[model samples]
Target: MSSVASQVILHPNVSKSLKVLGTNLGRDKLYRAVQYFARFLAWYLVSRGYKVQGARWNALKSHLALARKLMRLGKPIEHLQAALRAAQIAAEPGEQITTICRQLGYFGYLTYDTLVWANAIKFFNFKPSTAEKVSKNANRLWLAGILFSITHGLLKAGRLANDVRKLQNAHLTEKGQDVDRDAKLGNLYNARDATRHQFIIDLLDVWIPASNLGFTNLNDGVLGIFGLITSLMAFRQQWLAVNGK
Candidate 1:
C-alpha cells in the first residue's frame, strides 16, 4: 500500500501538472478556462429562467476576470519588449512588420486594460463614461493585435508552402546531390503545424474583442465557448512547453 501510494505521488504526469500550474501563464489559462465556462453557464441558466443560479455563475466570471487583470499588471512592458526584440530580428519584411504591429497593439491594449482594471477596483475614480471609453479602446486594440497575428500566420503559411514546393522540386531535380531533403521537410512541416495551431487560436479569440467592440453581436454563450476553446488551446501549448514535450 505504501509503495502504491508512493508511485502515485511520484507519477510523471502529476509532476508535469504541478509544473504547469507553477507558472503565471499556466495559472491564468486555467482560470480563463473556468471563467469562460462560467460565462457560458450563466448565459444558459438565465436563458432557461434560472436567474438566481445564473447570477452566481456571472459573479464567478467577473471575479475571475478581476483576478486575471491583477495577474497581468505588468504585462504591458513585456509586450513592449517583445516588440523591440521583433524589430531587431531579421525576417521577411511582411512578417517583421506584422509581428511588431501585433506586439504594439497588445501593448496598447494592456495599457488601457490596466486602467480599466484600476477603475473596476476603485483605485481610479474615473467617470463611468470615461471608463467605458477606456474599455472600448482596449478591446479595439486587442482586436487589432489579433488581426495582425492572423495576417502574420497567413504570411507564414504561404512562405512555408512555397518552401515545400521549392524543396520538392530541388529533391526531384538534384537527386544526385547530398541534400537532406527529408530532414528539411520535417522541420518545415513542424513549423507549419505550429503556425496553424496559433492561427486557429487567434481566429477563435478575435470574435471576443469584436463582440466587445460591437462589431459582432455574439452573445455570452457563443463568446464563452470561443474563449474557453482558445484558453484550452493555449493551456495545452503551455503545458507541453513546461513539460518539455
Candidate 2:
C-alpha cells in the first residue's frame, strides 16, 4: 500500500487532519505545527479579552498550559499525570463534575490498557491462552476509554446547553420576548452544539483500534508503534500455528 494509505489505515484521524491542511509534512512535524498554532491562537484570543464564559476560560487556559509543558516528547506516565492535573483544574466549574470524572476515567483505562499491552509484548514466552486473554483485556480497556470520552462530551455539551437555556429564560422574563441575543450565552450554545457534533465523530473514530485510545486530539505516535508491534506479534503467532512450529 502507499504511504498515505498506510497512514490512513493506521491513523485515520491524524491523516485526515493532515490531508485537510494540504501539507506534505511528516506526522510529527504537522502535529507540532498544529499544537503551536492552537497555543498561539488561544493566547491571542485571551490577550484580546476574548474568553469562554465561566470556568470554561480557565479550562482553556489550563489546557494551553498543559500543551506547552508537553510540547516536547517526555515520559508517557508523566504526560498522563500532567493531563490528569489539567483536567482537574479545568473541572473546577460547578457544572463540569461529570466531564472531569470522565477525563480521569479514560486516563485510568488507557493506562491499564497500555500496561497490559506492554506485559504481553515484553513476555517472550507467553502461552497462547495468556496472550489471548491479554488481547481480550486490551480490547475491553479500549472500549472503556471510548465510553468515558463519549460520556464526557455528552455531559459538557449538556451543561453548556443548560446555561444557554437559563440565559434565554432570563432574557424572556425581562423583555417579555427575545430581542437582542446575549452574545456570550449564544457563544456557549454554539460551543455546545459543536461539542455534540464532534462527539458523534469521536464515537465513529473510537471504533478503530488505532485511534489513540481516544485520550488525545493529536497523532499518537507511541500508540501507533505499539499497535504495529502487537499486530506483528499476532501475525507471528498465527504463522507458527499454521506451520506447526
Candidate 3:
C-alpha cells in the first residue's frame, strides 16, 4: 500500500536488496535524497501494479541456481540464442498491425519481461551467440563490431566531413569516410550513447548505473556492470558512428 511497499512489490530484486542492505540495503542515512527517489520509484511501480508475486518467488530460485552454477561449476549460459529467440517471439509486437487502442487494452507489451526480452532479442540478432560467460574480449569485439556497423553506416552519408575531420578514426583513415559519415545523427555518437544497448539482466534485476556521477546505484553489480556495458556500448557506437568502412 505504501510507496516503499510498491517498489519492493514490483522490483523483487530491490525488495531483496533492501533486505540485504541491512534492512535498507546497507546504504546510509546520509543518502536521504537518493533514498527518497528510490522510495518514490518503488512506490510508483507498486501503485502501478508492476510486481508479479508468483513470478518473483519462482524467478529468484532459478536465478540463485544459475548463479551457483556459474560460480561453482562455471557453467555457461547454454542455448542462449534459442532462449532469446523464444523469449522474443513470446514478447515482441505481433506481425499483425492491430489498432493502438487494442494493443493498449491488452497490456501485452507493457510488462517488464516483454520490454527486456524484446531488446535482448534485438541484441542477439546483432551480436554473436556465446557458449561461455560474457567476457572482456567478447565485450571489446562486440563493441568493435558495433562501432564498425555504425561507422560503415556513417560513411554512407555526406555531411560528415567538416565535423569529423577532427575525429579521424583508427579504422577510417585506412578506408576513408563515406556518405554515411556526412549525415547528422551526431547525438547517436554522444557519450551517453551507452544507454542504447540491451542490458545484462538476471532474474528480477536489471542492471542500472551505480557509480554516481548522477544516478543511484540499483540492482546487483548495478554501477560497475552497467557502467561497463554503457562505456563499451558508447565507445563502440562512437567509433562506428565516426568511422567508415
For lDDT, the strongest prediction is 1
Instruction: Give lDDT for model 2.
Output: 0.51
The TM-score between candidate 3 and the true structure equals 0.18
Q: What is the lDDT of residue 133 in candidate 3?
A: 24
Which residue runs of candidate 1 sit more than 4 Å off their true CA positions? 1-7, 172-179
lDDT of 1 at 3: 100
Q: Provide C-alpha RMSD values for all models, in order.
A: 1.8, 20.7, 19.5
TM-score of 2: 0.42
Best by TM-score: 1
| Off by more than 4 A, model 2 | 1-79, 90-101, 108-125, 172-181, 206-245
Give the per-residue Cα lDDT of candidate 2 at 97: 48
Model 3 off-target regions past 4 Å?
Answer: 1-134, 159-245
lDDT of 3 by residue, 120-192 (tens): 4453332333312232232333333333333333332223343344444524454436444444336435412
- For each candidate, what TM-score against the reference? 0.94, 0.42, 0.18
Clash pairs of candidate 1? Answer: none
Models sorted by TM-score, best on top: 1, 2, 3
- The clash count for each model shown is 0, 0, 21
